[model samples]
Target chain A: MTSPAITVDRLTKRFGAVTAVDDLSFTVAPGRVTGFLGPNGSGKTTTLRMLLGLMQPTSGQAIVGERAYRDIRRPAQLVGAALEASSFHPGRTGLGHLRTLAPQVGVKDARCHEVLELVGLSGAKKRRVGGYSMGMRQRLGLATALLGDPSIIILDEPANGLDPQGIAWLRGLLRALAADGRTVLVSSHVLAEVQQSVDDVVVIGGGRLIHASTLLEFEELASRDVVVRTTDYQAVETLVRERGWSFDAQLDHHVVHDVAAAEIGAALFAAGLEVHQLADHGADLEAVFLRLTESSDAPTTQFTGSASAAPAAPPAPAAPPVDGTVAPPPPPAPPTTGGVA
Target chain B: MIAALVAEYRKFFSTRLWWILAIVMVAYLAFIAGVFGFSLTVDTGADAQASNFLSPKEIAQSIYALTSPIGYVFPLIIGSLAVTSEFRHKTVTGSLLVEPRRSMLVVAKLVSSIPMGLAYGVLATVTVVAAGAPVLELVGDGAFLGDGDVIETLVLSVVVMALWTMMGVAFGTVLTNQVAAIVVVLAFTQLIEPIARVALGAFDATSEVSKYLPGAAADALLGSSFFSSFGGEGGGTDLLPQWGGAIVMVTYILVLAVVGRLTTFRRDIG
Candidate 1:
């Protein structure tokens, strides 16, 4: 099978008044594993569905190998996808399920056993899917996706029901698929779930593109912030604003970005303020993801400018943390993402 | 196209539903045929009405044709399930992934349901003959299996079964919800249509229209029915000729299949 790049060119899907996918654009190049990351209800599945031609885009297009999915001569052989693990007839055995698909995929019955073995489901090939555990069903779903040995593999939340070992196995398998020059797009709400497998990340929130870049570039957006709590809140807030450090002032504490915990502690000590707590709250990928998606509207331009310059961009002071520790200001500019075409 | 057809057949045989429904259909047809054969042939001293209205041969032919009138529901259900089960289970995603052409998938489903319908037809016919012939031979005239009209009705019964199954597939394609499709099939075939046909046939004006109903068309296609043998021309409506019945059933299948293809079949699988 030929490896094909998937391109979503301003694809938009509006369900009545609500837009599920709002002019989202991203190109998934071949020979790399790309993570389609977003929180739940962020239109990740809608984008994938449009890409697979399982859904209609309101406007624009999703092109696979330069053609719409419906126009592909043999789509399964070109793009193997498993959108849901539960998309199986419970009465059918794993092998039976594969056999039903094998003929349409233009593969021999022997290929069914081969995929079952590939997904580590050979032993339970004869057992009905109704009796299979969620993890086993996930394996079967992976097996189904691998049936045609397609070069472009799209799996939506494949690791949702897997155990640690299964997740490890999936990571290895995804890496191996990309190593063979396939374009693998695996989507998940949690960035860490696919952190080890994906080479690039395309993040979306509220049906709009928030960030798209290499994983290394995305990780570089994780800034080191210092959370400082003190009795002299007025003085600390004045110092933070005076130093031009981006910060979010909570009711009892302040999260100061682009500054070390030691620096904040020294500043507090010099002011003779009673420092109750000072800790380095190193912003990890999860935190960066939350920051970007939580204030998705504000960061749309901030992150999309360039990953390297993302840190230097002014942080939205009003963009509150998602932990619900503070009442966030009302978000502004709902549909002003730069990717709108 | 051939690959899609093979895939559809593989889908059908992979489930236990076909055989389970087959068993239910066999028992139903056999019990109904046996009971009817016994009651119609038995010498009730009240009146010689059974013998005077129709010959033992005509009665025997009617019993053989019972395969279509009473047993068509099984093939109908099988056809409906063939389409509805895929949607119910969301396997249409996998199906479209392989074929990608929605129209081709619908065509494959329509074509594949034919052999399934034929298989059900043969099974239902065999059950009727196996259970009904013995009762007919013992108390009434000899089992007229070789008679031309009986043989014709049996063959037509098989064709009728195949048509009914195709109709089921078409109907299921239009009404994709599994519960709704099955309920509609059972209620229309078992309750609504029968009652409607009788109610309509009770009048001279509507009796002609009642013969055009699906069940009546199927019975008309088979060229005989025990219900018609007793009530012919007096209380019951006259069925269309065999060719006319075939045309009517084929029209139902074609119309339903077309509507389903243009509407639900073309809609996004999600």
Candidate 2:
């Protein structure tokens, strides 16, 4: 019943003849982190800009906390953002920049150092921003975004250049922010990072919304196939075909299509084929992404995690297990699983 | 709006480029005074009786005139930097995100430039005037505070220069490129305006039209002193009356400012 933290309704933007964002509509709720995922040149940043009132939409409205960004009387105290974390004066020290922005945002002077410490940049607070590394700049940016103590935080590519430690730190920070019942909208091209950090996901491609769903629903809808591996793989394929079940043939396994793993196992056992390994491909979001983005010219055959469209790298090995502790099995199948043939 | 103005002020002062420009203006003033001091020493032979050559009021007026061209550069640079830094740093996205009413932001910037411009204008004038005091003492002529007109002229000149600086901000916003804006202003102020003004004097209609030029408004600040040496109503009439110059300057500022605001408010920050 509560109003969404961010509402973008029927938003559109045109640059000359090209429509960058076309009738895009979505809402991000409070108390959760929403990931805004899209490919490059897909108008994600443009949409964010419109939402923040940095650029007026051609037609439609964007509201943050029930009011337009322009109408927010004390904006910084209501919504904090880091659009470009590095857009700071090179000569100004990190703390000095915060101090300079403090009076304008109407926050207490002490919050400057408070946010600095919160972002783990307290050590580099006195250093000029020019000398800080990219990771340090990202932390400083997070500090600025948190300085106002606002209920809403928006960041674009917040993890673009972070090291693994920085990324882990950022993941924890976002989790903590959402835990405090605040709204967080983060945009990134990396689906894996978003999968790890956000509760909800809104996928956009070519400036249009592809899907908006909870992470569980997205994974359920996207993870569609099960791979069955057995020493009698040939017999299993024959049984699947004889039963009119369609599946992809692989080196040592069969990716049974449409039918469930239990159904496949029942059919295989009925055919007198002993199954050694049987499991669904463990939560590969890329398959769903490929199906969603699939078209005649679109490259869907190379679907894999992180390196989907990388031409020279071959296919991505596979998605890591969802628990984050285990790596996905190696490629060229071990003659017991159903995947590559 | 006030918050934005304050923020713009902070952005302006926080730059090392601004500090460097300030030093340049102050140093230029002192350097000119030093050169003038050298000239007086050579011309007056250091005798107390011939000290009239170093009259402080005359020297003050002369320094005010001689360095007038150089004094205008700071405000121009300040105005350009105020807008261009946003583009150069890509902070326009962050700033516009905070203050969505971008026209108000442009207005804030225009308002903010006034103080810094005033500081430069006042300081530049004061430095030249104050430094002239001792040099004039070396000449036999006594120092004259003169009437309130001197103070008024100095104050008005500073105010006019501040407006000039805001005009530069509008220029920066329209161009959105720091270097291009600065170059255009410098070229027009230093070279083109002077040439155009002289060429206009050859014909009465063009001469009258030239009064509306930005340079004409700048020259108007000095009042009758610009025509002091000539006879018959100082031998030259203003292109426009003094008030007309103010009107012309304000008009230039408003047109460019409105265009600048509209452009900035509508354009995508990225």
| Candidate 1 Cα misplacement greater than 4 A, ranges | A225-283, A297-341, B231-235
Error of 2 at A332 (Å): 38
Query: Whose TM-score is greatest here?
Result: 1
For every prediction, compared with the true complex, DockQ reads 0.78, 0.46
Query: Best by DockQ, which number?
Result: 1
Q: Give the CA lDDT, 0 to 100, for residue B219 in model 1.
A: 77
Could you give candidate 2's fraction of true interface contacts? 0.55
RMSD score of candidate 2 (Å) = 9.2
Give Cα distance to truth, residue A261, candidate 1, Å.
11
Tens digits of per-residue lDDT for model 2 on B23-127?
888888777765654454345554332225435455445445433444666677778788887888776766765666677778888888888788878877777
TM of chain B, each: 0.96, 0.82
Stretches of candidate 2 exceeding 4 Å from the true structure? A1-3, A224-281, A294-341, B33-59, B139-149, B224-240
Q: Poorest 10 consecutive residues of model 2 chain B by lDDT?
A: B227-236
Query: Model 1, A237-302: lDDT tens per residue?
Result: 898888788899999999888787888888788878988889886657898787668655444343
